[model samples]
Target: MRKFNVFIVLFTLFSLFISEKAKGFEQAGIYSAKIETNQQQQRIYGTVTDQNGETLPFVTVLVKGTNIGTTTDENGIYEINVPGNVTLIFSYMGFKDYEISTDGKTKLDVVLLESTVRLGEVVVTGYNTVERKHLASSIESVDMERVVSRPIIKLQEAFAGTVPGVTMLQGSTLPGDVPASISIRGISTLQNAEPLVIIDGMEQPLTDVDPNQVKSINILKDAAAASMYGSRGANGVIIIETHRGTTGQFKVNVNSWFALQNPLNLPKFVNSADFMRLRNEAYSIQGQPLLYTDADIQSAQEGKTPNTDWVKEIIERPATSYNTTASISGGGGVGTFNLMLGYIEENGLNKIEGSDKFSARFNTNINIADRFILLADFYAHRLKVDRLRRNNDGHGLYQIAWRMNPTQGIYYENTDIPNHYMLHNDMNPVAFINEGGTWNYMYDK
Candidate 1:
């Protein structure tokens, strides 16, 4: 019985040794090798460790520029089949990649250093700023410098196509009547899906802020958003940081630009002569009486009658728009402060439509005794929009012009009367905009 027990003990010990050796062979890519293939391929074996000589398990050992690779075992032991004149790369998660050449020798051990890239960059999150690598998968940040340089009249228009997982709603051209709105990636919620917006740590509408003054915009989605503001950030969170003074002498900057606004495309209607001919042809095909006489058609074709272009009469070409912004920023022992003044004037396609806006922003940080700091912000803006009447929203204004008959001119032959009447089916679109029957809207906030 004693001899049999000793035999069992020896058998178990030998079985463990074979299992460990097989695992090492599998990790080295030698388990799949054939006896004849071993004669042509060279086997390179190595151990990957950290700078402190700690073994790094599961490290990848790959032949450079080839899809051949293998992973190290738990003991950091890796063996790969190579062509002798090949380079090998060693990589591990969160560590710098280590590379070496197999210049005829077999053994090639390397130590990998930890990567510093994740430790350097920072990201703004819900409660505080975190390192970029920690939350990069759930957060998106905008490149403000690139976006601010665009020629945008409304600050809301600046975010047209900058970030991913965010959608900006279509804006209006009715001067100050348009406000910017954006929706983040759709969240599974019964409530509204609009993302929560916080500008300078304060709840405010996005349209009220100027694009030039923004320094950074951080969007938090998924778990990163829900853990911050609870249900308020259920859909998503957009945090906006405005430009503040830096530690430097007083610096002044002025930016100005102008753009020619024109309608993208407008419907072209047939002239009066073509309209009469087409109408007569249609009625004749339908076996109905023609509306115009032969003399009228003859006179129209001979250029004796005028072709009224109602669109040109009401719409202005190359509507001029200009924007200017000036800002002063500085800092001292007391604290930092930034003051900016901006103005924008825009002419719409319609003759009676135009807008001018003035805005000023001042933000400061004052250091108190030793343990306190005061942050104060002031923003004011005034807007004036012409012909944006309370009753007429301008949504159907252009449609009326397009549907108007081309037979009537802008004014009557008798110009002695003030507000000379232009009639088209007793409804003239040009008169609604040009006849002093419109209202202007002025807003200050």
Candidate 2:
């Protein structure tokens, strides 16, 4: 392999016609410069490399608008004589051409950027895999590295901008607002438009799986690809493969991240002063009794009196959340074993609304006999989520919070209940979250 590579490099360098032999001249900046050239011509030579500094053999170097050119050697070095100042053009297959002015100097190393088209690359498709040149179906691979680089709590959140044909709608920032649906081909039918998600050959909800455990994800979007799954593939198909044990020495991996959660856009509401003044003016115009007296209005406007903000009270801002996952994997001549443990704490927009999850997974492959291996895997997780209560009529806590009167206090000064202040209204958001009610959901799977 090394000899083959050396041969290719040498062939590429020799393919280009190098300049006159070096004689009694210093090197070009860093490389040996060819000298003893014509009085009217100058020596220009440099190495051509790719973005990563790998020497690119077979690169074409030419003086713009002329046939005078040379190909880069196996070492990517090209020595040429230029007649006065001119633009030097560097061209290579599979890379963008680079141009630079001689600018009256030597040592002009060039770097070329690789073209976006990646040919001959292998890709996974529906029920099969093929190279890019042979692939007839539309498939997208998710960048799991970029996805898990951050502290993402949900699977859909990691995929928002990672792949094409996936759409994420504006949903609540609350911890319980888990993604349940996705659209790839748009609304083609009236039934479930959610794409079919297959994890390790088992059909399941993508949102239920954790991003840390996922190894690779492939999406099948074209009609030809969807045909394999029948109607279920009409929406789309997502194939996921989880991380497994590796052979050789034992390895331990741990990942932990912290993130501050905040709403992208919070609703803007009128202040208590403006709200009170507007209400009083309306009452006066209707010939009804004024809600606030001159002194009361002055005090409220001057910020002397308390002006409650239900929205702020209902939603926690800049909530902090974190997650940690640890795994151990190894393999021997007889078997391989992998075990993982994870914990996550996710805070929601509303105080007292959050989620805690604990998960464990163990997988092993035992070679009971040659050519006959047994695979056993076990996974368990416990999840507990807390959120504000909702009524049968769908009047959720946030809706009630938005409609609360600005003047209505969260709680009365005195209350009949011992050691507890009574709420000014049955719909008080703070009271509901503090005492009225809340919903706690626990799941073990």
Candidate 3:
């Protein structure tokens, strides 16, 4: 009876101890699970700025060692949820990368500095990218942003007064004409002093290219810098780099402009009465009869119907021009793409002369197995120009007007030919300009 009682007491004590220990373990596990759930997630907020105290938009903020990331908004603010112990990375192009530990904090503000290493400032040469400081030659670079901000029709027009050692002699203000005669370093040779122009490793006229598509323009002003082209580089060299796609999220840009132009520094001409009187005096000195009758001179002085001001009749005022461009660019791990489209319409001071242009460009880069890169660039443009015939010569319509007798009628009542005007030298400026005097040029490339 004593042994049985002792065994029961011992067993009951063991049971109670085991039950209490198991309950303790269960409470500990529940507490551990609660702590883990709380630490698994955290809401973070931050702002990013540059060294200049300017807020940086579109900056990439990423969680380190994870696929979770978000971009800063236009206001340079970001919000993300991440693990408490993880690190946050802030990155931007042309700027240094920055990192910070969460350290149980929920807000982080960062400022990134521009990269300082001069070796990374690359200028595209003919064959490769050479750093600006390392090049052992004279070179000048023009920022594309400044060039494109100006409202101009031709790409070459942007070079005027912007580039050093480049003289742009603009011959005429006519639409669709070559913008200027470019002379590099002041007339190196007597014949063909124009520089050799290279656009994206191809030789083509810069006038055909859209200013919006240009990324950079570099001028190699010395033999040392331009010797890569051998004999062709004697005049100098202009290397143009076009914009390309970058690996990032998709983006689109659109730009449009409208401009009005007026004719500048036009010659002042004498009235009909003064011109005729001067002519008669010269003719009289040479022992010749007077060209104008007494009635004609009286009519001219009184502002009669025969007196003509040819300059006012020919030129139009407030010439209008417009251009619009749009581009889309994006990329991924596999490849990148850039597409652009543009349209331009320009009217000259002379109503009969005008031009219109349409352009499209596609540029793509594809990575082949992380070893080879396939690059494809395609550009096409259509240009149409309507101009006046014989206006390109010295003895054109303007010259004809100087010698025309204003007393003559624009149209004769007894003329057999259709639309024939009665005039001196048998050449009427109005008749020539209005009748079959327009030339149309269409170009496709």
- In terms of lDDT, the best-performing candidate is 3
lDDT of 1 by residue, 1-445 (tens): 2433443455456445644653464445443443435546788897888989999998867665533677899999998777546778777768987778898888888889999867336777756788886664578888777777777776567667888887778756666666456778754454776788888777777767767778888888776787878888888888888888753235666676778867777777898888898889999999999988888878877877767777677675567777766676755434667877777777776666777777788899886762477999998988888873422565666666777777667777757887787776766766767664667778899
Q: Write the per-residue lDDT of candidate 2 for residues 1-445, one digit (tens) a residue.
A: 2433443354334323221111111124113212443346678988999888899887877665543566788999999887678788787768887889998788798989998766436566646667777777788888888888877887877767678777766454566456435677565573577788887666877655778988888888878555788887888888887777753335667677778866567678777778888888999999999887878778878877667788788765667777777676755435666777677777766567777877777788886643677878777888888866652122477787788777666655556755354455456667776675777888888
Superposed by TM-score, candidate 3 places the C-alpha of residue 219 at a distance from the truth, in angstroms, of: 0.5
Model 2: residues >4 Å from true position, as ranges?
1-120, 283-290, 302-305, 333-335, 349-351, 365-376, 390-395, 414-425
Please report, in order, the local distance difference test score of every candidate based on alpha carbons. Answer: 0.72, 0.70, 0.75
Residue 157 shift from truth in candidate 3, angstroms: 0.9
- Look at candidate 2 and give me any clashing residue pairs: 9-74, 13-73, 13-74, 16-71, 27-33
TM-score order, best first, reads 3, 1, 2
Each candidate structure's count of clashing pairs:
0, 5, 0
Find the number of clashing residue pairs for candidate 1. Answer: 0
Clashes counted in candidate 2 amount to 5
The weakest ten consecutive residues by lDDT in model 3 span 1-10
Query: In terms of TM-score, which candidate is strongest?
Result: 3
